[model samples]
Target: MADAPRSTPGREITTGERRRKAWANWSGAVRGIADSLLSPATTDELREIVLDDAARARGIGVVGSGHSYADLVAPAGRTLLDLRHHRGIDTVDPAAMTVTVRAGTTMRELNQELAAAGYALPNQSAIDEQTVAGVVATATHGSSPGLGTLSSHVVAARVLTADGRVRTVTRDDPELDGVRVHLGCLGVVLDLTFTVVPGHRLRKVVHRKPLPEVLADLGAFRDVHFGGFWWYPHTSQAIVWEASPTDEPPTPPPARPGALLSLLCNNSWTPRIAGAAHYAAAVAAGRGGARVLRRDDALLHHLPPPVQGTEYSVPFDRAADAIRALVGEVRRGGLRVSAPVDVRFTAADTGWLSPSRQSPTCHIGVTHPVSAHDPQGWIAPLRAADSVLWEFDGRPHWAKVHFRTGRELASRYPEWDRFQELRRTWDPDGVFLGAHLRRLFEH
Candidate 1:
């Protein structure tokens, strides 16, 4: 028999070693120049590293899979606690339909384990490379009027606070709502228990229609188990996706349309070519078809090309109007967006900092491929679209790029002060604080 890998505490790696392994995020947008990087294997070791007398004043930040496109994990001149090595399921309470996993576990890994145990997450984002803690911390969401964001599903969490104490928070705890989306400010999350359900399957259908037609009857779209759409501004076409529960046996997934066209469109050299092809395809497929697959298979989609963009959550009732306004602005400004505008719906949640808190929300995201020739071409349109969404009282996704300041964000969220108070209580010395967080809180 072989021994399983386990985390163990040891001395911090040398400064030279840290510099040699410089870190960059998934989009290569934010790069870090940290003083040192620590990979503590066990909870005790992590506590020791965080509580070290000399390291306390220098600050500490935790980095997961670095999947976030924002600057949440990049803290210059501070220690980065990389948790990638500390991963795996800890326990499963089948009777209660719950599972506890290390905070560093990725969604893809968790789904496989859950399937083996005849259980699964009720809802999940399209991409699954993000770690459990990272996803929950940022309030990551999928599209569904019935399902809430990922943090809303957390039942309990074991966290290592900034002051070197480990606290177990349950659903009954008052602080759980705030802790669910702590932004790594309150503490270092060790593990989390999420409520799950019996494994099931889903049937997904995709089709194209005029934007006005879909918006006229938005209720029909929201009534499904999961519904979202992509709007092509240039073509006035909408690619709609709706998923529903299915009792049929699982089948092999279908091949995605236009693999070569997608490749060409995503390539930096042929961006214009890609845009033309996409517009033509959307026009060609006036109406689409359906496919049935397992729950996990249906929820996960292929990773798209690197994109720099912003996402905002607006009131559900205002979704159609907001999109219409944004489209008008983009068209009026002559913005050349190569990608479709993504629109998703989510039910209200209880997390204090969740964008969808206590209100049914519609998320609108605009993206464009990174262009080397015209590096800043996407900025103008994105800002213009952002302005339109802002007028509709939209809230920015914590993990995505937005130009909101502390005052602006505080004004939007009623519980902002309470969350700040909790952050102070948990990390008075600001050990876990970073530049981006300071910008959002210190103001």
Candidate 2:
């Protein structure tokens, strides 16, 4: 009965028909096969599917850009809700400096639309491939000590719960924080309203510093307006990126070809992209050049292609020590890795499941892009970093690789018990939660 869903525009989507579908995240880290794939184009249709006895019996799962390194979105055997069709800007109120976007809208599409309308997000994650819903669901963050996680930008949300009621959660609601980063557990989000800012440009400055010097005083760089660093421990050098909001006229397309190749490229050859960028960066190091980029482009940096990585948010004060211990552990475990570790910072926020919850945090991300061709290579390093990160009270990013189960992670998050209570109250029958998510929360 849930198979004949139609789009909000009154046209039936071709993919709405029930069929066997194979699902895999980028980098092929997590994958599964779905028995039925459905794209409900409107909120009413989503509610219908939620209330349908057959659909409820089968269980429901949602997938957006499939970019997560964790097995968070693998909808094996569940009736998967493919959200690509249910995307667009529902409303943009320039006077209020806010935009209402459909849950399935990708950051790339929304960024373009926002720019066209003379506004933009306050900050964005490293890459723009994720859906805005996925960004909020995972508590995606940027490297600005002044900015909170993307979920913090949400002023309101519209979600469909298992009780077959469509609820609009706003700032005044007691459960707003719970809904902010629901991890696809609370319910099916229809759309969200985000607070936006006027369009602006950023000046990105580059500096190459010895890794030891950076480790000596990491706090000095934490206040950089909107920038972070790419650390190459093996080379003992770090590529420092310092970006600040600017009103100056933009610079011409990267003054040098090395800068251009290093910053922008075709996505086909993942490994070569890393090699070429690293070589160019190594050559351009310390020349201390600067370039101006649009706010969206400036927010995004080179995340080595074909990436499968793990990230943890630790107390800002202990981040330097955590990094030292992480590197020591990797060496102790003898895990061979080549991807530069990404270092960034974020302001604290109120989300119950947010990594930076109640703490001004420094995020250390260890990536192994080369392992995209061999996933087995990532496990050793991922496990190696866990103890060091946990010892320093690091909270793992929900959508990246981490080894913490619900019970293991409960003690770390201050609001863990509260989130569990809300999930239990909202989706008692577990219609929106699938097998993978059950393992994450119920275990």
Query: Clash pairs of candidate 1?
Result: none
TM-score of 2: 0.89
Tell me how far the alpha carbon of residue 140 in candidate 2 is from the true structure, in angstroms, after superposition.
0.5
| Candidate 2: stretches off by over 4 Å | 1-20, 252-281, 284-288, 331-333, 370-373
Q: Model 1 shows how many backbone clashes? A: 0
The lDDT for every candidate, in the order shown, is: 0.80, 0.78
RMSD in angstroms, all models? Answer: 5.0, 4.3
- Which runs of model 1 end up more than 4 angstroms from their true locations? 1-19, 256-259, 263-275, 283-288, 372-378
Cα TM-score per model:
0.92, 0.89
Which residue pairs show collisions in model 2?
none
User: How close to the true structure is residue 72 of candidate 1, measured as C-alpha lDDT?
Assistant: 88
TM-score of candidate 1 relative to the true fold: 0.92
